[model samples]
Target chain A: MYVTLKDGIHDPQGKAVKDALSVLGFNGVEQVRVGKYFELDIAETSLETAGPLVNGMCDQLLANTVIEKYRYELIEK
Target chain B: MYVTLKDGIHDPQGKAVKDALSVLGFNGVEQVRVGKYFELDIAETSLETAGPLVNGMCDQLLANTVIEKYRYELIEK
Candidate 1:
């Protein structure tokens, strides 16, 4: 799952990174958006059951939907 | 680029999310690791020129080599 700040919300951390990169001589960074990456291990193997299960988790906890948006891709293990 | 804490560093945010998920009765979440996801837009187009450019950025600013490790897949836009 990847969670990112919404378009209108400013990312200070990303701005800092871009500035620091420029100071370090790595240029041409037009834009940078920082986000969260989650690698999860769950017991449910079937996508049918797990999709809603994980989505429920996201709704209840992982993402703060008011200011942030999340997208996920489930890969079978 | 996906930047993650090296093993044994312990991820408090991940643990907190897991505990919250359990409290919400979302079970079977065995493990969770939280990391940083960076979406960068740069001027360079060719892989040959851009690979090292981005990697240098990671080495210098994005990933703290002391405790975090990073991997990236170059996707042409």
Candidate 2:
């Protein structure tokens, strides 16, 4: 699962990126925002098992109950 | 950029999920892991501009200097 700060949230990391841009001489840069990513491995071969399992992971662990939100995609290897 | 703990690292959130599963009567559940996600809107129209810019965002802010790793994909609206 991947979790991130929802839109309209203050992002300290994004602020730092803006600051770095000015330092790197990248002028006219206005803003930045950051988020999270995840890659998961599941024993199940079907979405029926994977979807609910992953969603439960998101609700229980991948996302912060206070501010951030989460989403995920399953990849088959 | 989306950032997450490198594999083999202990994930506290994953641990919590395991705990929750047991509470919720999911006895066979073994593990859980979490990560970050981002959706970016860029003024640029090409990968040449978007790629470096997004990477800079990742290195400067989106990812922690220690423990986590990150990757991202571009989405067009």
lDDT of 2 by residue, B1-77 (tens): 66778877889876765677668655545556666655555667777788888777667766774887877787654
Per-residue lDDT of A62 in model 2: 56
Candidate 2 per-residue lDDT over residues A13-75, each given as its tens digit: 867666776687555456666665555555676877888877776676557757887767776
Tens digits of per-residue lDDT for model 1 on B2-74?
A: 9999999989988987888888997799888999999888888798998999789888889999999999888
Query: What TM-score would each prediction reach against the true structure?
Result: 0.92, 0.62
Clash totals for all models, in order?
A: 0, 3
Evaluate chain B of model 1: give its TM-score. 0.91
DockQ score for model 1: 0.91
Q: For candidate 2, what is the DockQ?
A: 0.30
Candidate with top TM-score is: 1
